[model samples]
Target: MPGGLRHLGEGTAAALARELKEELGLDTDQLPEPPVLRWVQDQTTTRPGSTEPFERLHLIHTLNVPDSIRSRIATTEQDANDTTQVVWVPLAQAAALHLYPAIGSVLTTPAGTSIGPVELPPMVDGTYRWR
Candidate 1:
């Protein structure tokens, strides 16, 4: 999504939960324990359509989808604005796409300030980690 931080009020798990419920109408209880939370920083100074200074610390939450629920889930407008787009791409293809570098070093060091030319992690089974 373009303005994920904005959509997530105060940037808390509960807020995210509320957002998900309002946006996608997905029940958080259907999700598994301890959703994957990744911390990222948007170091870029110049962003499109904004005069306010930017702060990093973008947290991305990855929720597991049950096979049954996956089939029922659909992207809403909120999801689109909060996320770029929801696509069903294979892990191999997704891995080949250029993703933000900060996503790469999450398991290790914080990735340097850069975007693009980075491969995303693979999706295993039906669960995929979000960055």
Candidate 2:
């Protein structure tokens, strides 16, 4: 996932889609719509030496990779501001690994604020829901 300071006035899904387009150079139309949104709050010291509080909403989406283009993904830096390299991990393996302790806790409690946990409803069969 790409990480950077986000500008105000933009919604989370729009910001994530823009980031993917700018950072991966992939056609937005080819990407799947986000099915879930997970909000996280973080406090950090900025480059200008000021404490800043920010909320990150993780937009989760799955993409179907065609065999032809699979090997060519992640070949370039489409966004200059992007600082992290993207990697693809198999879903089954990812779920089996022991991730950071905080990662698991985030789903149970809101971070850095008093907000409560955001529960995502399960999807029903055959419906297109995009955010």
Candidate 3:
């Protein structure tokens, strides 16, 4: 999913739209509906070179990109960070990768189906589990 943190005073949809266009050459009109805020998670993390631990809130939203748009997507993506390969892995096979806000239970749902708006239990060892 094309994702990014919301800028100060910017709403979620705006941030996501910006990321999608910047990263995948897509726009907000391609979305089926307003993105769903599936869950909010807080994980304590240290910066790349810092020793200080800070709380980071991850707002996980589901972007329902239509098959038409998805089909036209390129095999690679770029962001402010760097260019990266886009691997299309089936949801059933996602368990093999380390996904943050760990898409734990939702991995079992059919692709394109949204997960929960439910509160997930606190993460164990900094890994977000959806159960």
Candidate 4:
């Protein structure tokens, strides 16, 4: 669930593998294929008090991981001093939570509506602090 921007000339799959090692210390040898890009969000926003605008393109990947592996990775330390607490929320209740990029929109939609990529609206006012 934790990843970073790919290095110059580095493939997405390779970058993902490297990120897993740096973030959760997970080994990807067991996986048949690398995680695929699920969501791509392009956002432009100004930090709480900043007058200047910040623009970013975020890519999200999803993988089918074993429960044992998930548990182990969730407890491990991640990159960039990230202290994100991973919690599993049922889809039925996820819509009510504060999810970044408001992924709830997709989760709340009915199946078979879209087949390919989805674009999410920009994140609104919020404060971010990395621990």
Each prediction's number of clashing residue pairs = 3, 0, 0, 0
Encode model 4's per-residue lDDT on 41-66: one tens digit a residue.
77676766677876667776666677
Best by TM-score: 3
Ten contiguous residues with the weakest lDDT in model 3? 122-131
Candidate 2: which stretches are off by over 4 Å? 32-35, 38-72, 80-84, 95-131
**lDDT of candidate 1 over 56-76, digit per residue (tens):** 445555566676776665554
Model 3 per-residue lDDT tens digits across residues 26-103: 776867787777767666655456667656566776666678878876667866456677777776677556676655
Rank the candidate models, highest TM-score first.
3, 4, 1, 2
Locate the minimum summed-lDDT window of 10 residues in model 1. Answer: 122-131
How good is model 4 by TM-score?
0.69
Instruction: For residue 70, give model 1's deviation from the true position in Å.
Output: 1.3
To one decimal, what is the Cα RMSD in angstroms of model 4 from the true structure? 3.9
Model 3 clashing-pair count: 0
**Pairwise lDDT winner, candidates 1 and 2:** 1
The per-residue C-alpha lDDT of model 1 at residue 51 equals 62
lDDT of candidate 3 vs native? Answer: 0.66
Q: Give all candidates' CA lDDT scores.
A: 0.49, 0.45, 0.66, 0.66
Candidate 2 lDDT (Cα, whole model)? 0.45
